[model samples]
Target: MGNCCVAGASSDMATFKWSIDNFSSLLDKGEGWTNSRVFKIMGHAWHLKLNPMDRNSCDEECVSLRLQLSKTSVEPNTIVDASFRLIIYDQLYGKDSEHHVSHTFQTASTSSGKSCMIKLAALKNSSGFLVNNNCVFGVKFIKVVTTKAKTTSEKLFVKNASTLPEAKAAYTWCIADFFGMENPGYSPEFTAGGYKWSIRLDKEENHISLYLKKMINDLPEDSAVLVEFTLSIKNQEGGKHLKKKGLTQFSNNDPTWGWEKVVSMEDIQDSSNGYLIKTKCCIEAEVTTVGSSKMK
Candidate 1:
């Protein structure tokens, strides 16, 4: 029989070493047993078992190694998900042999490991494995997965889900250097109901792109607002303005909504249309309806 020394133990990983002091005697006597001390990891206790001459193997030269839960430390009906590595160290050479596997331990007796870790003949033949009368076997817990089951439910009851009141507002922004400005332009922030809003303007392939953005930094998670609005490019020469109407829901994930082609670039470039004049342009947003929610 041999003894094991627990090197270190942690929540996610642990290591231990088993030493056979009299290697020649174990090989000659055969059928020897060894086990390690209890080691706790992630609130679970574990230990290792080694057999010098595995009775379960057809080949007499083979050995068996297993990782088991400490029966005294485990609770009834407890389950553990884990992965580990069994290692045979070479004392002389740096070449080490290892076997890795995963298992689900459902009971106190349930164990996970290799039945045939290595052959005793190979261990004796290798110079690095067996030095003098000493041999080393090791185990490393690579992962320990813990699962928690929670049970609960929540519901928000609104007295009138479809009859909430609507709010309306409008804002207009003027850009002095329209032609010399950047590709994307932003309007000043405005308040509408409980939320702040802004307008974004960009140049799309030969057209103008406009979007309405809902500021969500101050809002709580899962908050959403339904809005109906109009985006327009004002005709600087006092002609009819070009406009697009839209209706959409605004949430954290989808904070902005708009059209890529609100008005063609040809219309703005043409002097006869009067959409742009003296390097200046105007943009307007009319939030016609904003649906809000009330919590009880």
Candidate 2:
């Protein structure tokens, strides 16, 4: 910024008017002598430079004026996309000479940030400039905004997830506890896929049998929840564990879903195998659910 005055603003865009009472003496100060002010527009700080005398790219006989964005005010990309209109008021004729611009403005190294609408010559008795030693200018910025919408077409949203140790579901039944059973089977309810779920041992069957169950009422038509998981019997000796991969879904009539017979009782009861350890066994499920809903 050079020699200039900062004043109060009016209306939407910023406006500046300067009256050089000693116009002849100001121009004589030097060619590089500029009158500039640091102003804010569109939430960004900028400099409005008015060079009465000629500068590098400006002609000797013309008055050079332009706008520049301050370095600290720009975003990280070092580029600004904007649309603006600059105005130069010819005070002598009461008509404004305006230039409209809309483009992507780059950083300081790529551009000088100079937007000059006009270069008023020092013409005596001219209608284009210098009305009683007064000059006026204005700048207006146009803003852009964006919005998002939903579609009916199915969209897949995937995320990586894991279960915490504190939330793990495990249960062990002794021989006496198994014989004195009251319900259909032994089961422990847990939470997964943002809903209540459980893994159960099929009590009515004589052989090795289990199933996964989801507790939920009827959902909206075309809305479904599919859960894929691996249920494994934890091993103590670090040998390969007995694991079964299964997938289940939530529907109106049937919520309990899983394989009817996954393993045989003979293989599971073998003490040498890792499935039964110290008369205690454990079960773990790694679950991932994908829910789809029809968009209206």
Candidate 3:
């Protein structure tokens, strides 16, 4: 016997070739014996059997071939899905004779393999298949790949943040105070995505910093949340806003995210920039957060 391998685009495909000597004598075995070989492909074992002629089936001119997967090591009677093809190659002229019948193997099947037959007279009458008493046979099995549907989380907040149902005063800092402030102030709290969130204005020199805080008051220990949001410094005079978008996970110890300098102190104080409306500034946030056990 001879062996050969064929490569396909996906690493999943397995192709095998077998050569036979004294080809005519093997066919004379009839139903008494079948020429078969066990081979591994796509992580499973399969059987390929060939009969030279079907003289017992009232058709001496026909030949038979079978392709079957070995009993699996998986659970008893496990359903193994597969797709494959079997061919009796005509090596003399390089023309491969496709049996052209059925070759699909699936889970819902009652059997594990497929069998095909062709007229020996047609094969011989063609060319190159049975030459010098030697012939080649081959089988190709395809790998099936499956993927799950992707899921995404989303949220919406009322335009009036002051009336937000789960909101608390996330943070407040004396706008003009800088030197003595070392930490974020008390924040306004709200819930989105499966976690509590807060917004804080940190007092910093020359700039007003902001942050979204993960509220831990009622949170379970080691809790984590995935947060996605867009924060904007809305210009009350004009709509040319300063905006930022981000996605990150917030854990108990690191629950905040925001701009360190939302707008420069110089930009904030500029009258023509639409940033200060009679000394009052406008801030806006659109957020979506979720409870996530795995992150990528």
Candidate of highest TM-score = 1
Better of 2 and 3 by lDDT: 3
Q: What Cα-based lDDT does every candidate model obtain?
A: 0.75, 0.55, 0.59
lDDT of 2: 0.55
TM per candidate:
0.45, 0.38, 0.40
RMSD of 1: 11.4
Candidate 1, superposed: residue stretches over 4 Å from native: 1-3, 55-60, 148-296
| Candidate 1 C-alpha lDDT tens digits along 1-296 | 46676755744567778878887786677686667767666567787777777754465667778888778655555567788888878887778778897887765446775557778777767788888878888888888775542333333333353554453477888889887777798888987655788999998768889999987665456555667789888888888888889977677778899998777888888888777887788888887434533222
Tens digits of per-residue lDDT for model 3 on 181-284? 34665445665555666667665667778777777645445555556677666667676977777777666667677777776778877878876666566556
Model 3: worst 10 consecutive residues (lDDT sum): 168-177
- Model 3 TM-score is 0.40
Candidate 1 backbone collisions, by pair: none
Judge candidate 2 at residue 246 and give its lDDT: 66
lDDT of candidate 2 at residue 267, scale 0 to 100: 60
Candidate 3: Cα lDDT at 241: 74
